[model samples]
Target: MLKYIRPYLLWTLLSPAFMLLEVFMDLLQPQLMSRIIDVGVKNSDTAYIVRTCIIMGLVALTGVVGGVGNMIFSTKASYGFAKDLRSDVYRKIQSFSFANIDNFKTGSLVTRTTNDITQIQNAFSTCIRMLIRSPFLFIGGIVMVCTISWDLALVVICAIPVLALFVWFLLTKGRPLFMGMQQKMDRVNTVMQENLAGIRVIKAFGRSDFEKQKFKTANDDLCNASLKAMRMMSLSFPAINLIMNVTMILMYTFGGKMVFNGALKPGQIMAFSNYVMQILFSLTMSSFMLMFLSRAGVSVKRVNEVLNTQPDVSDGTNRDAQVTQGMVEFKDVSFRYPNSGGDPVLRHISFTAAPGETVAILGATGSGKSTLVNLIPRLYDVSEGEILVDGINVKEYELNALRGGIGVALQESVLFTGTIDENLHWGDDSASDAVIKEAAEIAQAAPFVSRLTDGYETALGQRGVNLSGGQKQRLCIARALVKHPRILILDDSTSAVDLSTEAKIQTGLREVFGDMTVFIIAQRISSVMDADRILLLDNGEIIDTGTHNELKQRCAIYREIVSSQLGEEALKA
Candidate 1:
């Protein structure tokens, strides 16, 4: 947090400097008013009164200048700090591995980046202005009040401890509630995001009532948490005012007698009252600033948790290793999610994929086929054994150099809101028009894309909602193809496409990228029927490995799957 302030040091310093000027001007005005009342009016000197009034006006103008300058510089410093902090937080999140992301969850990270950072920024802005001004005014007022009448200053002195103690009590009680409030806000945001993103599903299934209830529950929790925190803070204002009023009453009671005895003049007693109010006002401002700081303490810890976290995955020792040939091998690889603390999701998986060969993995819904392919790109590191790419251990290659050579179209077809051409550029930003169209054609996306009024320049809705499922999937495949990667992994990428279109895509892939290593994870037997080799996975282990024909001849599970999907007559053939 201090490091973010370093860049804006000039503005941070200037804000408080101007605040000091303003406080000084404020302190001067009370004395000038005392002189006008005691000397000018007492002697009936109109000239002195006019002169003092003009001087007070000039002092007010100076204070205004100071306040404006303070606002400008403080805003600059605080906003600049927030910008840098948010950028660094976002960058850190981008570097996180799958395991790291799973730990934080998407909704919680979003809240920390937005609401949490904003809380700290506002606290910083207030500190440079009010925090700097309050203490100076409080001490300055006390000194001036003492000079006017030492006896009256004693009233202010007594009230200070009571106010200080009450503020401390409220702050101490409020800290944990504020932390809990922030967590509840995260829950509300998570529910809202899920509702918006899955609105189509909710509507299609007629579950809108259920989703509404879910959001209401989260919203009510946030409201209750916020009310608890605010209720504690609200006790401060009335208690502070009561103490202030009582002290003022005591001041006038004692000072009036001093005036009657000629120990202090009436004009001096008036100045004394003004200084007492100033002192109490400063305390009130300080109380509010302390509250802000207390809440900010919680925000600071939440933000630092992200910054100080060492990513589960870091850069490898061999930072310069790049893949020349797509040769991937898994040597008895096994993995389980770090946070799950259960059996390995993938167990004893061993396979070798050579350049120019196509290997397919077939499995049940939870057979870990996708997990096996994911390790090749190091999305999640294997808990046991090793994975090698081009004969070099994957853990020894720089993450960027290793991932850059492989193009993956995941099981989920995610598309951004942009022109089709821009989305394709995500794979290879420098790819030319011809290369993009070629890739689109190979993925069987070009014909539908061409039918659009703007062709490849058609603008899409958020997450490509304007397109059909098959259309989005084909575009994802084309985006991966645009990379012209040495290796390609399509994890159920063509599930939404028709069988004929899927066949054409498979044919086009072989024609254009014959030498690229391809791994296909599919449930449909026909999808892998022509592959060079197929591995049938059951649970977390491979039950059979062979070409389609060999598996049909020797493996009972493979024969059952073939009979179910392709028919018993087709299997006999």
Candidate 2:
């Protein structure tokens, strides 16, 4: 808990000052009450009674001022802490490698950043304010009680053991229950998140009933865990209350006898009773604050675990030799996902692409085609070998310099909620209107974009959900083209576009990108048939490499794929 709160130390320190002022005000009221009862009410003096009543009212007003000041400091600190902590977590998440991201359940990450932070905030608000209040009242109450009668103060101390025992039980039994509750919340979040993301798949498969049952089990487990924690907490509160009531009753009987014997004045006995009650009240408050800290302790540990994970890919700053040209080479690069103890994704691979050449990789799914391209941008480190650009190992180049040379259209395209121009500007922020228009036209995206009511300024829904898959692909292509990167990678980006549009895009790409290097990964043989070089990959190895005519005569796998996709009549025609 301290780790999460440490960042906001300046405000936290300021927060206690206001609380101390509030405690001083509270102390004044109790002292004034005793004086009013003993000197004013019992002495038949109207002037003294009126004066003391006014003093008590002034103390209450001071308490109000202290409360307002405390709120100002606490709200500013808690909100600032929440905002900065969220930004820190989000930036840390972006640094994680693909393998590290896969280790976490998506829902768990969401819950930790959101719900868990709220829990910590609530604990902060309660603990800091009440923490000072409890301790001040306890100490002040003891001093006041001793002034009134030392004998009665000793009696109150006798009940201290009971309060200590109750608090001990709460801490011992409730901590584990709260920890289990947090884990249960994670499971609940996992099921809910999975269902939300895969709702379309669930509906398509007609598995509504099965999904409902799974959700029910997760929800019930969370409910049971929460109930168990509440039960343990309930026992502590009632036992403390019982001890407080019994202690008060014994004080009343003993003090009443002493009052009748004239050994104690009526005002002093009343003061003694108030002091004893205040002491017990502080003890009860301290117990509650301690309970909340236990829960926050668990939450802080989980949050810290995510923050402490070292990213597999490190950003290399101060890279002197940036990849100036589009030249790329791979020297026996290989990778195996940590969870899967199988063969590496790419084995004994060696390749080089000169500037101004089009290289195409054709393979079935899971042939490591995407993984191969991912290494170019240094998204993941190679297991055993090195990848180089411009004659320098990729790892030696800064991340910004290495990625700046390339523009990638991934297999899964994403768009933010903004006008079309805003999305396009992400590739190159200073692009002129003319460059955006030219790039959009070259990608064959202008026709549909022009049909929209607002054209280039048209607002898009999140993920471009309103656009057709083909239109979204074309926009992604245009965004990539606008940057004029030295190397462009299209990872099956044109699969959704019609053949006519695809041909037009290819023709346009040839004219403006004359000396640029392009790496095209496609399942369609037609997509890569015209490439300067074609490489057929299977099971992490390149099975064949040749031009279109050369592969048709010598490679059986290329021939079979061509025959199956286009058919004998289509191929012959």
Candidate 3:
């Protein structure tokens, strides 16, 4: 953080320097006014009065210029600091693995990046301006008052300890409440994100009222926490004002008696009163700044949490390992989700997919089928044992190189908002038009795509909401197909398409990518029947593995699934 400030060191230093200049000009005015009243007005000297007035005007102009300079430099330093911090935080998040992301969660990270950083930025600007100016004004005013009359200055000085104690109390008690408010802000953002993402489901199930209630609950929590923190802060105004007013009254009552006794001049008494107000005003501003500082302190801590966290999954030093053959092997691999206390999702799972072979994985829901294929790309590392790609440990390959060799279309097909051609280019940005159309044809997406008014140039809504479920799935597959990877993993990506379309896609894949190793995870028995080999998984372990006919004759689970999907007569046939 300090390193970022180093670049703007000139502005950082200059801001405070100008702020001190502004304070110096402010202090000079009170003494000048006193001389005008005592030496100029009392003696009825017009020349002396005019000369003092001219000097005061010049001082006021100088103060204005110093103020403008302070504002400029302070804004440059603070806004620049925030920009660097925000960019660094975003870069750190990009480096995070799936496990690292899970630890912080989306809502908290959003709050840290946005609201927390804003808070810190505002405080930093205030610190540069008020934090420097207030102390100089307060201490300078006190010194001027002491020169007027030590006896009267004592009354002003006596109020400092009491005001300091009260301010300290407010700040100490306010820090935790402010921290709680920031946390409630995270909860509110989380509720909002979940509701927006799942709004369709909420409306389909007629749960709008339920969602509204949930949002209200989160909103109220944030409101209540905000009120609690603000309530503590609100006390500072009246309390500091009350002390200021009392100190002023004391100065007037005591100093009048001194003037009558000829111990202090009438002009001195007036100047002393002005300086007292300046001291109190500076203290009041300081108190407000302290409250803001405490809140900013909490935000600083939250931002640092992200900056300081090292990613659990780091890049490998071995950048030269090339994946030649698409041979994938899971060697006694066991895996569990990070922070999940339950048993491993895949336990002692071992399998092998030779180059140029189509191996399909069939499993019940929650049987770790998707988890199995995810290991091939090193999306998540295994809890125990190792996964190898082309006989090299997956961890040993450079992440970009490892992922670049394989193309995956996940179970939930996601489409970005773009034209059909633009979305397809994600697989291979440099792919020619002929190559894109060929990949689309292989994924069985060309028919629907051609029917649209703009054909391949048709624009899509977010997540391809304009397209039907089957159409979206096909487009995702097409996107992956454009990569022409050495290995392809389709995790039930074809489930939404009709049986005929699915069969055509499988046939097209076999013809176009006959030599590429393929891993398919599917629930439909018909989907995996033509694979070179099939593995039946149950509860994170491989229950059986064989070709279609071989599994039907010997594996009870395989037989039952085939019977359920195709009927007993069809299986017997």
Candidate 4:
């Protein structure tokens, strides 16, 4: 926070400087009025009254100019600080590894970036505008009143300790509630995001009522927490006002007697009352500033949590090691999810995929098939062993260089809202339109794409909602193909396409990408039947390794899968 403030230090300092000028002008006006009443009106001196009026008018104009300057500088400093902080936070999040993202849920991160940052921004603006002005006004008012009459000033001094204690108590109690309110806000955002993303599922399953109830619960929790925090802060105003009113009554009662005794003038009593009001008003503003500070403190802590987190995966220094062959090997590799405190997802796994070879992995769900291939691209680091690409340890290669050589299409195909051409450009930004069309044709997506009115220029909805599951998968595959990476990993990416179309895609890929190493994870036996080798994974270990025929004869798990998908006669054949 201080680092960001350092850049705008001039604006920050100027705001308070001008604010002090405005407050000084404000303090002088009451004294001028007292002199006009006590000296000029009483003595019937028209020239004295006229001269003081002109001076007062000039002072008022100066105060107005000071106020405008204060507002301009404060706005610039606070808004600039927020912009810098938001950019730094977003950049930090972009650098986070999958493990770091898992630690902070998507909804929570969104809340911190948007709502939390906004809260802090508002508080900073208020601090610059009011935090400085109020304290100065309060102290200045006290000094002015004391000079007028020390006897009456003692009344304000007596009320100060009591009001200060009460305000302190309320602020202490409200801080924890404000913290809880922020957490509740995160819950509400999480529920809202989940509801929107899965609205189709909720409607399809006829569970709208269930989702509504869940949202209501989260929304109510936030409402209650917010009300509690606000309610605690509300007590500050009435308490301060009551003390202020009582002090004023005491001042009038004591000073009226002094005036009757000819010891104090009536005009001086009026000015003393006005100065007391200024002190109370400044104290009231300070109390409200404290409330804003408490909430902003919570937001500051949340933002720092993300900014301070160091990414678990850092880029390696060896940028010169290029992955030319696409040969990947895992040597006694083992991995478990961060903080899972359970068995490894892949246990002492080892395999080698030579360049240009097509290897298929077959497994039941949760068999760590995707995890095994994920290691190749260094999406995650292995817990116990080293993974090598092109005969160099993956950790030794720079992250961009390592990942750039491999193209991955995950099981859940995701697409952003953009033109089909733009989405494909993500794979190879320099690719020509002809190359993109050819990649789409190779993925068996040309037929449907050509039927659309706009063809490749068609716009997609969020997550490509306008397209069918099979269409989305084909587009993702086409995007990967456009990269023409040396290593391609398709993790059940073709599951949504029909068997015939899947076969066409496989054939096209093998024909066009024959020189690229391919790792295909699939449940369908037919998908891997023609592969150069098949790996049968059960649990976290590879149970068998061979061609389709060899696995059918040697592995019972493979035989069972074949018999289930095809008939018993077909397996016997």
Candidate 5:
């Protein structure tokens, strides 16, 4: 449709102009061949022969120029359109929420952006050049034949309906098969991506064979779908050839009689025969252009699906929701991922972190601790009730402003393949070296980092694989600290380090940032025991919240957790 092609209308039209010129030149060829046979050879007119030959040479040269021009235009249009579409798709992806992104696997999206877009580009290029050129040549050839001899043109016309039927058959059958091929490609991409990304997990579990079987199923599906499409495409050529060869035989049989009866010249018969074959060949090529079009129709549908999905999180009509003093409050908030029907990940959560106080969250694994913190940044919007950051609905504030006001450290740390300095700069690009060093010390990362050969400039492997788990965690903490955010979240940041090292990091942060709305999520009771307040969560709801001494008497869940870690005698004391 025009939606895809309108981006390149000027070149799209320009490419076809050259094709029309080429078709005119092609019509001249058959006429020139007739002149060579009748005037140049038969009568031995040497001057006439040279004059016609020169004209033919000029037309051939012009055809070559037009063909090159068409090719150049074709390339520009398709590549430029693809470039815009690629950027559009990527920008659209940026608009999506965590809930939206998690619905589709990352691998399938990569394939749609890359391989699927390429398929559409190829189809567009072919449609613009071949579709126009072949039709022009076929129609022009027929008109030229009619002028030369009406009886000869009739022989060509007789085969037109048969070619149309063959083309129609190919279109209806091949379209659905190509769509299946594209779907199969998505499955193949998913399996290959999983194998590559989880290679370490597979080896650790010794499940290489299981991964191979998954890949094989996807691969086999792709192969079968491709073969089915090719099988449908194969029907096109032989059917056209049968019609072409039959028409050629009829032309020879009919034209020979006219020649013997002194009605048509032998040279005219030869020219008419060449013209008939050209028409048939051009029709055959037109069929191929149609097949590419049908295949691309399916690809366009797939690309548009991604383009059309409205992001779950949108920057809507309401603007500039008030932000005041970095106060984060969760009141009866419940959040469930969109895929979940009504099972809340965090249920009836209630908390208030004053601008200058630190709140620690303690729970066992899968206790919805991280889910609670995610609300502050609005990564996944709450399914029921409201979450307020800075006295406004987190949804109402401009998303970047809300996210910018807070800093978060995830349970598992991540770092890009870059120098230590570059990783730190992700927190704040304008940070000075002294500030970065200060933050690193607060993370308990300075001692080991200063010993590295290049220190801040040392190259990190992909995802910072060159570093130990504890080192990576420390770097993540430094990245967050460099932000110096009003509201800071440490989601199990110390789980990777020794108890002594964690205590040191904790002291350094308190000394520097000083009770700046910190939320520490931890398994160790000692980590959160001395906070201004502690929230104890089980399942998705907060069961008890208090100072450690207060919770020891009131909350059974808190006592059980304390007893498990420090023993009943320690709790009694």
Candidate 6:
């Protein structure tokens, strides 16, 4: 946080310097008023009154200038600090691997980046202004009060400890409540995010009422938590006001007696009262600033948690290593998610995928087929064994070099809000129109894309919502194709496309990307029937590995699957 402030050090220092000027001007006001009342009025001098009045106006104008300067510099320093911190946090999140992302909820990360940073930024701005002004005013007011009438000053001095004790009590109780309030905000955001992303699903299932209730629960929790913290903080101002009012009453009682005894003049008592108010008002400002700091303290810890996290996957020392042949191998590989405390999701998975071959994977739901292919690009590291890409251990290759050579389209086809051409360019920023159209043709997406009024220039909705499911899948495949990767993994990418279109895509892959190693995960028998080899996975292990026909002949599980999808007549063949 200090490092962020350093860049704007000039502004940071200038803010407090200007605030000091304002406090000095404010402290002069009471003295001038006392002189006008005591000297000008008592002597019956009209010119003296006018002269002092003009001086007071000039003093106020100077204070205004100081206040404006303070506002300007403090705003600059605080906004700059927040910008740098937010950028670093976002960049750190981008560098996180799947494993690291799993450690935090998506909503929690969003809150940390946005709301938490905002809280700290506001607190910083308040500190720059009030932090300097309050203490100076308090001490200066005390000095001025004692100079006018030391007996009245004693009344203010006694009131100080009571105010201090009240503020301390609220701050101590308020810190934990503020922390809990922020956590509750995280929960509300999580519920809202999940609901928005899955609104269509919720509607389809007729669960809108249920989702509304769930959101209400989260929202109510946040509202209740905030009220608790606010209630505690709200007590400080009134309590301090009550104590200050009582002290003022005591001042009038004692000072009136002093005036009757000719020990103090009426003008002196008036000035003394102003100084005491100034001191107590400064204390009120201090209490509010302390509350802001307490809330910001919790925010600081939350933000630090994100910035300090070391990503589970990072670039290796072998910065120059590149994947040349698209050869991927898993040797007795086994993996379990970190902290899962359960059986490995994949076990003893050994295979070699050579260039120019298409290997298809078949499995039931949760059978680890997608997980096996994910290890190729090192999305997750093998727990008990090793994975090699182009004969080098995956951990030995630079992350960019390794991932750049592989293209992956997951079960979920995610597209951003952009023109069709822009989304395709994500795979290769410098790809030419000819290369893009050719890749689209190979993925069977060109015809539909060409029919759009804007063709490739057609703007897409979020996640390609404007496009049909099959259209979205084809575009995703086309994007991966644009990468010209040496290896491509299509993880049930064509699930939404018709059988004939899926067949055409499979044929196009063989014809256009003959030298690329391809791994296909599909539930449909027809989708993988023509592959060079098929791996049948069950319960996290490969039960059979062979060409389609060999598996049909040798594996009972394979026969059952074939019979179910292609029918008993196909199995008899």
Better of 1 and 5 by lDDT: 1
Query: What are the per-residue Cα lDDT tens digits for candidate 5 across 403-463?
Result: 7778888887889998999999999999999999999999989999999999999999888
Q: What TM-score would each prediction reach against the true structure? A: 0.98, 0.93, 0.97, 0.97, 0.96, 0.98
Q: For model 3, what is the C-alpha lDDT against the true structure?
A: 0.91
**lDDT score, candidate 4, position 311:** 90
Cα lDDT tens digits for candidate 6, 205-261:
999999999999999999999999999888886898899899999999999899899
Measured by TM-score, how close is model 1 to the native structure? 0.98
Tens-place lDDT digits, model 4, residues 1-573: 788888889999999889888999989999999999999999999999999999999999999988999999989998899999999999999999888988988889889999999999888888988977899889999999899889889999998888888888988899999999999999988898888999999999999999999999999999999999989888887888899999999999998998999878988998889889889888888888888988899999999999999998878889798888889888999999886779999988888989998999999999999989988887777899999899999988888898888999988899999989899998999999888988899888889989999988999999999999999999999998898899999999888888999999989988888888989999899889988899888889988899999988988888899999986976798
RMSD of each candidate? 1.2, 2.4, 1.5, 1.6, 1.9, 1.3
lDDT to native, each model: 0.93, 0.84, 0.91, 0.90, 0.86, 0.92
Which residue pairs in model 5 clash with each other?
none
Compute the lDDT for candidate 6: 0.92
| Candidate 5 segments whose C-alpha is farther than 4 A from its true place | 1-8, 316-324
Model 4 weakest 10-residue run by lDDT: 373-382
Off by over 4 Å in 1: none
Off by over 4 Å in 3: none
Candidate 1 vs candidate 3: which has greater TM-score? Answer: 1
**For candidate 2, lDDT tens digit of each residue in 1-573?**
456578778777777778878878876776788788888888888899899899888888888888788777787778877777777888888888787787877778887888777777777877667777788888988888888778777778889887888798889888899889988898889999899877878999999899999999999999999999999898877798899999888888888888899888888887788778889989998898888888887777777878998987776755686666788888987777766788788887788888878899999899999988888887778887898887888888778888888888888888889999999887899999999998899889999999999999999987887888989998999998998888889889899998889888888888889788889988888889878888889988888888877888888888889899888764454
Which pairs clash (backbone N, Cα, C closer than 3 Å) in model 6?
A: none
Decoy 4 TM-score against native? 0.97
Ranked candidates, highest lDDT first: 1, 6, 3, 4, 5, 2
Higher-scoring candidate on TM-score, 4 or 5? 4
User: TM-score of the candidate numbered 3?
Assistant: 0.97
Residue 481 lDDT in model 3? Answer: 85
